[model samples]
Target: MTKNKAVFIDRDGVINEVLTKRVKFVNKPNDLFYLDKVPEAIGLLSSADYLIFVVTNQGGVGLGYMTEEQLEKIHKKMKIDLESEGGEIQDIASCIHKPNEGCSCRKPEAGMILKLAEQYKIDIDKSYMIGDRDVDIEAGRKAGCSTIFIGKEDNTVDANFSFPTLYAAANWLKSTSNL
Candidate 1:
């Protein structure tokens, strides 16, 4: 059976604004503002028939910064907003483990993406992972998916592609996937 192509996205910096690298959690639903052109980019991806999945490391739930219920609410709001803009995300998978805990679902680990790939029968090679951090790139590579780093030159993690923003990367993904 043929598998579907997909795009795995990071939550903090790719989908929503990253207030600061030091503090990486949307504690309140009110804090979940997105970067410019995010919804438009997502809509483009969706229209191009790429299954979109949000893979995030929301350690705040385990660290007591926020509750699981609060995270759910935040995600609910995100989905509603995205749909309002004509974008649809197939699923959302988050790792609630702390950074110190050697959890497989966290960034830098491909567990979440791998599991979702299996469940959704996704073609890892045909899929793209879009993220802003080094760990995000690492995870995508480890999962055998193309990685797009949404930042300037970063030596720690080498990505298959690098763009300054998710919108730019999404445009590239759309054009490249057609080839």
Candidate 2:
């Protein structure tokens, strides 16, 4: 069977706003605030036949800021909200370990992406990882996928491309011949 192509997206700061000062993590459903046009971006990517997966690092669970059940509830709400907006999420892979836990599934590590690629029969070479941090870009590179940084142009992170938002990235991907 032919392998599928995918787009791995980071949850916080990419799909949802990360209130750095007010709230460190989205521990509850009410804390979850989506970034502008995120669902539309996901829908656009889906239209391009790119399976979308949210790969997030939710260390707050390990830190006791929230429980696994609460995380589930938040994800459920997120899924419903996106689906209602014509966007689709194939799955969500999260690393619940603490920052120094040294887990393999966290951002900057290829474990999550690799496992998902295997599970979904995905072709990493044709896949892309869109995120807002250096770790996310590093993870995608380690996983053998193109990386798209969703933030201001920063030389610190070596992303293949940088965009202001997911929607902008989606548009570029749709028009790019490289993909």
Candidate 3:
């Protein structure tokens, strides 16, 4: 059987704006404002025929700032919006455990990605993980996928590629023949 190639993306900072001032996390559906060209970026990747999975760490749930139902509602709205804009997500996996919980599914850990890959028969070597933080890259590296960092030049994390925005990364992925 042929394995699928996927892009596992981080939620906050990468898909939506992280409002550090307004709230540390997107506790409500209304608080989930997307970044520029996010829909377009996802659409581009979708058009390229790569499966998309959102792997997020919603620590706010464990911190008592939000409930799982609220997180579901927020994700529902996100999916509706992205679908309306021509992008499709295969699934979303989130680790609601706090940072100190040391959960296997959280970022900086490969559990989430590994589980998704197994469930979907994804080719980790051919897949990619995109995020704005170092932990995301670390997780991707651990999972044996190519990592893409979407942020300012950070010398700390060793990502396969770096871009300033999701759109830029999508463009590169679309143009790349290796995928």
Candidate 4:
């Protein structure tokens, strides 16, 4: 059986405009905003036979800033919006544990990607992980996948590629990869 290649994307900061800085995390469903050309990018990867998964670390739920139900609402909206634009997300894996909880599924820990790799029969070596944070890149490295970092901040991430936005990265992947 051949393993599928995947593109694991970080939800906040990468796909959605997150409330960062002093107050991080979306407090309400309306707080979630889509970044530019997210659906278009997803579509490109999908057309290239890449399974797209949203891998996020939402510690706000565990920190009492938001409830699981609230987060679900936000995710539902995102899915609906993206799907309406002809994009599909294969799955979503989130680690809602607090920063001090010692969870393995958080960014910088490859547990979530590792589990998804087994469940989806994915080849991590052929996979790509795109995120806007250093921790996200670290997780991809730990998961044995090449990474693309999206953001204007200093290049603190150890990614194979760096782009200003997800769309740019997706375009590059489609053009460069045989997949």
Tell me the whole-model lDDT of each prediction, alpha carbons only. 0.88, 0.90, 0.91, 0.87
In the range 1-179, model 4's lDDT, one tens digit per residue, is 99999999999888887675533567677887778998898888887778989999989889998889988888888877776656688888989899879989998899999999999999998999899889899999999999999988565666898999999998888887783
Clashing pairs in 3: none
Q: Model 4: residues >4 Å from true position, as ranges?
A: 20-24
Candidate 1 off by > 4 Å: 20-24
Please give the range of 10 consecutive residues that has the lowest summed lDDT in model 2. Answer: 170-179
Global fold similarity of model 3 (TM-score): 0.95
Residue 142 miss distance in model 1 (angstroms): 1.0
Q: What is the per-residue lDDT of model 3 for residues 111-143, given as tens digits with 9 covering 90 to 100?
A: 999999999999998899999999999999999
Residue runs of model 2 more than 4 Å from their true location after superposition: 20-24, 177-179
Question: For each candidate, C-alpha RMSD in Å?
Answer: 2.0, 1.6, 1.4, 2.1
Residue 2 lDDT in candidate 3: 86
TM-score of each: 0.94, 0.95, 0.95, 0.92
Backbone clashes in model 2, listed as residue pairs: none
Indicate the residue-level lDDT of 82 in model 1. 75
Best by lDDT: 3
By the TM-score metric, which is better: model 1 or model 4? 1
